[model samples]
Target: MKIIKDDLAGTEIKALLQEHLDDMYATSPPESVHALDVDALRRPEITFWSAWLESDLVGCIALKSLEPGHGEIKSMRTANIARGKGVAKTLLQHLVEQARSSGLHKLSLETGTQAFFAPARNLYLGYGFKECAPFSDYRLDPNSVFMTKCIKE
Candidate 1:
């Protein structure tokens, strides 16, 4: 599988993002859902990528610049059929490498604190992310958990 920067205009990607949003809403309260939609991910500050296995889209992730050397992870999701296949691992590694190359010193993300988000939380923890207080414009929320990692440049 290969990771490619995406334009967020393809039907497949849109569907995937919608599925991601739906799952987020299903798992967390509306006030706690931070997953961005297609239009939000298309903004200039966000760089979105899609993981493809041949012609199939397996997973996706985005990096949104928060400051000169900091970024926030957004819209991470793997296709249902692609779970347990290391699709998210590969995509995350790609984003980490891309962040390092782009001079980003930190990467942070917010996810649900519910049981439905256990796998995702574990994935980030396994990737070296540590739990942290809310960053940027985020405030404390019972339904949300924040994680961050500092990249070595």
Candidate 2:
């Protein structure tokens, strides 16, 4: 799969982001859903990317710069059809490489605590992220679990 920086203007990516948001709201409480929408992913601080197998969209992820040496993972999702493939893994590796290249020393993300999020939690854990306290603008919430990793240079 080819992963490239996306402008977030394609209809396919828009649908994928909507699916991600829909799942976030469906699986977590309204106030606990932290997934960003399409418009939110376009912010200057966030760098978005889309994974594609030829013309079909495989998945997407974004890195949101939080500070001089930190970034928050945002809008990570694999297409329903691409589930079971290594799309998320590839996208994650891509994000980590980009973050490092951008001079970031740490990466963090917030995901739900529900059983529905087990797979996601496992994926992050396998990728070397460890549970941590809320960072950035986040606050402690029972429904949310935060993970962070130090990618020191």
Candidate 3:
């Protein structure tokens, strides 16, 4: 598998993101949804990457620099066909590595508190993320689960 910088214009990637967004909306209440739409994902602060197995897109992840020493994980998704194949893990590892290399002292993410997000929350915990109070522009919300991991410099 190879992870490379995504230009956010690839047709396959665009569709894949749409699917993830739809899935999030399907499983989450409107007020609880924190996943960004395509327009928000294309913002200047976000760096996106797509993981591929030859010609097939397996998954994608993004990193948003929120402030000095801080970064946020955004838009992490594994294609339906690629689930359980380690695609999401690989993409996440890549994002964490990038965050460390970029001098970010901590990486944080906001996910759902519902069962729909258990797998994702577990994955983040496995990678050393710990539950934390909301950061960035986020405020306390029962629907939101915030996590943070300190990246060694």
List CA RMSD, all candidates. 0.7, 0.7, 0.9
Q: Which digits, one per residue and each the tens of the lDDT, describe model 3 over residues 20-90? A: 88988998888777888778888999999999999999999999999988999999999888989999889
Worst 10 residues of 1 by lDDT: 24-33
Candidate 1 collision pairs: none
Give lDDT for model 3: 0.92
Task: State the lDDT at 76 in candidate 3.
Answer: 97
- Model 1: how far is 47 from its true place, Å? 0.3
Clashing pairs in 3: none
lDDT of 1 by residue, 1-153 (tens): 988999988999999999999998888888888999888888999999999999999999999999799999999999998999999999899999999999999999998888988999999999999999999999999999999999985
lDDT of each: 0.93, 0.94, 0.92
What's model 3's TM-score? 0.96
Worst 10 residues of 2 by lDDT: 34-43
Q: Model 2 over residues 35-147: C-alpha lDDT tens digits?
A: 99988888999999999999999999999999899999998899999998999999999999999999999999999999988988999999899999999999999999999
